[model samples]
Target: MGTYETAATLDFVVDAVPGLSSTTLGWILVILAAAFEFLGVIGLKKYSEHKTLFNGFIYLLGFGGAFAWLYFSFEYLQVSVAYAVWIGIGTAGAVIINMLFFGESKSVGRIASVLLIVIGVVGLKFVS
Candidate 1:
């Protein structure tokens, strides 16, 4: 298991966002981590044929970013509620990414799905 307190992980976030407001910073970290997660998973395409040191490093760093995202996520926002919002944001982002970047279908049904997801996210906004 990778140590969470390692200098490398700490350095990563500092590199990414230097400094930011608690709420804005938290959202940025979460988005960055999620994007990294997407790329890391997509990297598996290369893992089977030609794996390189850089890709391996990316994989490791992706998890590190994710851990840091969670750290800041709870630091600025309430855990349960923040997580609920993160889920919504993550879902909507994944769908949009899939549609635009991944060339997946985004018909009316898909658009509606996205809207519904945002609604769920908005609901949490209204909550405490």
Candidate 2:
């Protein structure tokens, strides 16, 4: 079979599994991208504290992986939706990580703001 036809056939076969589709796979990639973004954020924090080749490598690897995963997700999701969701998750996750691990502020307002961000991300998922 030709490349396009082979790919379509594979997709059809994969889609036969319950609760798994191209769109589902796309969302999965988005989540993975966010996870890699978190890794990048942590690497950034470490690199800021200490300038080292290893830390720099970690930072580059995390961010590069994140972008690669996000790019692939675009094939299965709307560009706008994918980009926004990715940013939203990354932003909120970074805030939380800072608060938890970096000893940043953990005040009620900050917590509430994080909640708002989470809600907004969920809303986007539903609307799109």
Best by TM-score: 2
Local error of candidate 2 at 95, Å? 0.5
Task: Tell me the lDDT of model 1 at 50.
Answer: 64
The alpha-carbon deviation from the true structure for residue 32 of candidate 1, after best TM-score superposition, in angstroms, is 4.3
Model 1 — which ten-residue stretch has the worst lDDT? Answer: 6-15
Cα lDDT tens digits for candidate 2, 1-128: 65653121225534677868888888888999999999999999989999999988888888898998898788788989999999999999999999999999999998999899889999999998
By lDDT, who's the top model here? 2
Model 1: per-residue Cα lDDT over 2-94, one tens digit each: 766523323345457657556665556566656665655444434544688877776667656666676666655677777777667766876
lDDT of 2 at 28: 86
Q: Which residue pairs overlap in candidate 1's backbone?
A: none
Model 1, position 69, has a per-residue lDDT of 72
Candidate 2 collision pairs:
none
